[model samples]
Target: MNLNRFCYFLLALAAAGSLFTPHPWVMWLLLVNMLTVVVYGGDKMAARKAWRRVPEITLLMFGLVGGWPGAIAGQQLFRHKTQKQPFKAYFIVSVILNISVLLAIYQLYPFSSFFTS
Candidate 1:
């Protein structure tokens, strides 16, 4: 497989991994992978102009809904980070925001307490 496809596969694996682990560390890894794709892929002109304009909200939604891996991988595979503009900024911001939200919820929620009662 090409480097692009390989990168995407890694991203998918990361995303799938997040679903099973409760640790915030997993999300961190996924975030790193996504950021890597966004930065490197954008610099290399990997995707299209229109697709590169994908909104930060979309990325945030994906991360929030447990699809960070796919979203990140899709960006790299589709070469959707060419715009060196909003795509990069929005992606980074959204990933950080999403991870923060997930971590916050995990720590504050009474998940274990409720399950035991």
Candidate 2:
């Protein structure tokens, strides 16, 4: 399959897998990521139409709250806000912060008991 299809397939598989996980947070993240993708697409369309546009802070908030995967995918697929100075810098920071928070949670609560009943 092509790159875009492959990316989408992976995302779909992740979402499906999250559905079967004991951790509710995984499902929540998948939902948030899907919403993020929609918002990013909306923002891109608005940009094209010279509309009022979605706020950058709103987009960043979505990314910070477990939607960075979708944010990255949107950036690549839509070619929106990929290289716009401080925005890109801030986006990178959000990705790093989100991952760090996940890692910290995993470290504090080890998966051995975290996912099991």
- On lDDT, the leading prediction is 2
Tens-digit per-residue lDDT, 1-117, candidate 1: 654455456556666775566664557455655655454445345334433433345444544444556566766586654465876676677768777977787788776653233
Shift in Å, residue 46, candidate 1: 15
lDDT for predicted candidate 2 compared with the true structure: 0.78
True-vs-predicted CA distance for residue 48, candidate 2, Å: 0.8
- The per-residue C-alpha lDDT of model 1 at residue 31 equals 63
On TM-score, the candidate that comes out on top is 2
- Tens-place lDDT digits, model 2, residues 7-109: 3454456567776778756676877788678778878998999876777877787788788998988888889989898988998899899999889988999
Q: How does each model score on lDDT?
A: 0.55, 0.78
